[model samples]
Target: MTKFSDFANTLQASDIAELLALTEKPEVISFAGGLPAPELFPIEEMKQVDQAIYEKEGRQAVQYGTTEGDVPLREEIAKRMKKSFFVDCEPKDIVVTTGSQQALFILSQILVNKDETIAMESPSYMGAIMAFDPVRPKYIEVPTDDKGIVPEELDAILAKDDSVRMIYVIPEFQNPTGITWPVERRKAFMDVINKYDVVVVEDDPYGEIRYDIEKLPSLKSMDTQGKVVFLGSFSKIFMPGLRLGWTIANPEIIDKFVKFKQAVDLGTSTFGQRQAAYYCQMFDMDAHIKEINALYAKRRDLMCESMKKYFPKECTFTYPQGGLFTWVTLPKELDAKELMPKCLEKDVAYVPGGIFYPNGGNGNHFRLNYSNMPEDRIVEGIKRLGEVLTEALAK
Candidate 1:
């Protein structure tokens, strides 16, 4: 028999991973993944971007680079932070990460020790929970509403628990819930955070995918005390396969993060970094994002409309202003996991919402992703899922 470390011992196969595998059959219309539309990938433009990298930099383009990542990519990211996120940061404040996923892992490792608490929204991103679990930290789910995390509740929790070392949030187009924090909530949340000594990890991967609403300033923009660490990703707006992301933080955290990342993978891909940087310099990234927004917006509207038409009146779901997913809540008696088999029988699928709650027990909800499917398929899938929910409710 083989022995593993304590951390390794605690690990188990993810239920979501297993569920996703089942949804992979070609006949099933899977709304399980937070996948980008592959049809929109800039494959033709990337060929030119790749040729430019090799022609311009030669061997240096593929060689080992500094742990802080490509300077040009960091510089480009800095401009984006100021322009899109309303956070005025320079290149020196940024460090290119492998992906925002890696940033989550590293931040948890560097910031928290075993048994310390990490505060998160009541139903938060599961991937963040997976990243933080390795540290063996206790989790405290703050009260969350449609507006986002409740400031007074968070203030009370932080005041009572000095062990809370970190707070993780997704203020824009959140993963499972697809909720965006209003400006008032952002200010109130920041005010509570300022009073506490904890570090805030603001993950904003889908901030640029908005449809109906005006852009709101990020929590990092309201961060007066250097307490917020902003995480950005190229996966949603650009190709996810490139595996590129960046982090902006206080100088101290960035220094520790770079040193820690040096031990993890030496640095993010030198060639991949140049690919993104060269593409940005040569092409209109904003225009490309506009195309993505248009397609996803259409899909979002279609999915919500279909749900309204097909779903039982007892069920409710969010009509997200933007983002890949909209959360659905079933009647209290019905469990989403229990209904998965029926959905699969109908050649439809969705992720059960319980897994999104780190501490568990919200089995009455599920999440649907509309960005990856076509219009006809989106309508058909929702109709099938509605039938399943209707049957469950009738029973």
Candidate 2:
């Protein structure tokens, strides 16, 4: 007899990885993976952090530590958030996690059950939904536009009943959509959610990567009331391998998360947190980030221009300001999955839009990442993607 329960049989593989494995094509270029620009990682600076930490705090560097996270690093994160995100947070309000993804998962575990309702945007990040789905909560999809989620719709969802416990929102350079909510819209959302008892999760992994326009204040900053749980990641701006991300919230929420963090993994890597602290204190993170923004801006420009020049006139795409992705809406009749086969044959890869939706409904949209490809490669990739797109819509 099988040892596992019936629940184990219902589990499904992550949709993102499933498609990747299914494609199995040799020359793979994944717009699907939310990878940061690896070229911009500060190799020399990281090496220096490792060397200095080992020289001074050698034994502690290798051994286990507190679950709340490295005190100095938590302090540094507090400083950075206060200055950059405009959220008036102290070290005690934060819980450092292995990654922001873990923080989100933990939040779902703590908040949701088979009965509680969680409000999410219609086409939110696939990873967030997958994390929530296994827990089997009643999910309600909030409507969205080019400016991100519609505020009135969110108001209705949150006002419904106590069953709606929390909401997951990606306010800036959101994954898949490549849309950033305006400051005014954010203000409206803050006003609405504050009135209701529902909690809002503001996931901002891509907040710092803005390029074309002036940076806007994050929703966390606008939260005059303690209703928003602000999550930040070092993966995009610093390095993905570090897997460092944190949640800043009121003490009640944070204390619970910290206790849970102790149970989950007993804190993130010690060397990782120490090195991150060292990197922030010594090196110029702003200078490094500026270099990243400039380079990604160039890539976004190249991709947009390439699509305009080479793609079929019917194909449309979003002009993202700061993040890596550029959301594209293919011709109405074209199926993104069907086109992927041809796209892969041409050595270009992109995610079909269907996967981003909570319902797994069919969609004509897809997401592309320009930061990984150089200008020349971007041009060639778009040209190749264009050829497949043209063929798909030709009939």
Candidate 3:
């Protein structure tokens, strides 16, 4: 009774979504979603901003916008890029999309052909993999370390394969792993990427959420060859309900995105764009972000300390400097997927890490998010998780 095409057959349900479904249970303590703390959201400020937008420009806010996006929002985004990423760019070079997720999908449409290769970090963002699935690109996994992707490994891979059209990387507070790249590695990556003609998709939704380290320069900032396509999102820093994100690339590349986006959604939400622009213009966004960083830092420390106190010596996890997640690598003989039901029975939940891989074979790993739960929840959840992990190791 199914009428779905082969293209539909290629897609599978995401593990992130599955874990998020578990989060809705009242008794469950979920470390599964990489969601920002609801307490940090500027609800009162947003309410005021909404009132102001309608009071002044209600018609324009509700009306359809240009495919390129609202001029003021684009201009504001370009300014923020210069300060944060250290890149000198004009508003014309940016294309506003529904979310950075859409930017990924649009880029996949514009750049990939059937069966062409895309070099990715071994445990990359599952959302990006899902976005690129319909294109059916071949994947080559490049190894990563505590300092992000290993440049030499990437160099060796790209050197032999000219068929790779793109190298997708998440250098800043990367999803799942929560590992950040150092300046040396970022420069080294650029050195290798410049020699080749492939595009580098820099998906950085958590770049600004640092805990106790200096900010590293973005790969896009060092991209003299125009090989980096930077994807920026407000979902992590701002509210996810707004669904505003952008693509920063060369003007020519942005032109292609603009055209394709026209066919996709015509434009991102006009009211949301205007409301976001007004809020940024009137509020101290830096101060708001600083408050958020401070709160998440406390949660991260609590989770790490709890793990140290409770987890078995055989289990090791990353101590993230910033970002929402911590990647745990269990003993090789154990399977994270097989451990999930046991965790759920303990009234706790986490994402099994094997799903982060495009080809899906690494079963000894899993990802945990510290941003959603409060300090008490983080401590108790990790304690419960520790018990689960210890029991698994014993068996």
> Top model by lDDT, which number?
1
Query: lDDT for model 3, on a 0 to 1 scale?
Result: 0.89
The digit string of per-residue lDDT tens for model 3 on 96-156 reads 8899999999898899898999889989998899899878899988988888889999999
Q: After best superposition, candidate 3 residue 125: deviation in angstroms?
A: 0.6
Candidate 1 lDDT by residue in tens digits, 1-395: 89999989978887667767888898999999999999999999999999999999999999999888899998899889988999999888998998899999999999999999999997998889988999999999999999999999999999899999999999998889999999999999998888879999999999999999988999999999999999999999999998999999999999999999999999999999999999889999999999999999999999999999999999999988888999999888899988888888899999999988888999999999999999999999999999998888887
Q: What TM-score would you give candidate 3 relative to the actual structure?
A: 0.97
Question: Quick one: how many clashes does candidate 2 have?
Answer: 0
lDDT of 1: 0.93
Model 2: per-residue Cα lDDT over 210-309, one tens digit each: 9977778988898877889999989988999989999998888888888888888987998899988999988989899999999999889988999999
lDDT of candidate 1 at residue 89, scale 0 to 100: 92
- Looking at model 3, which ten-residue stretch has the lowest summed lDDT? 11-20
Question: Which whole-number lDDT from 0 to 100 does residue 291 have in model 2?
Answer: 96
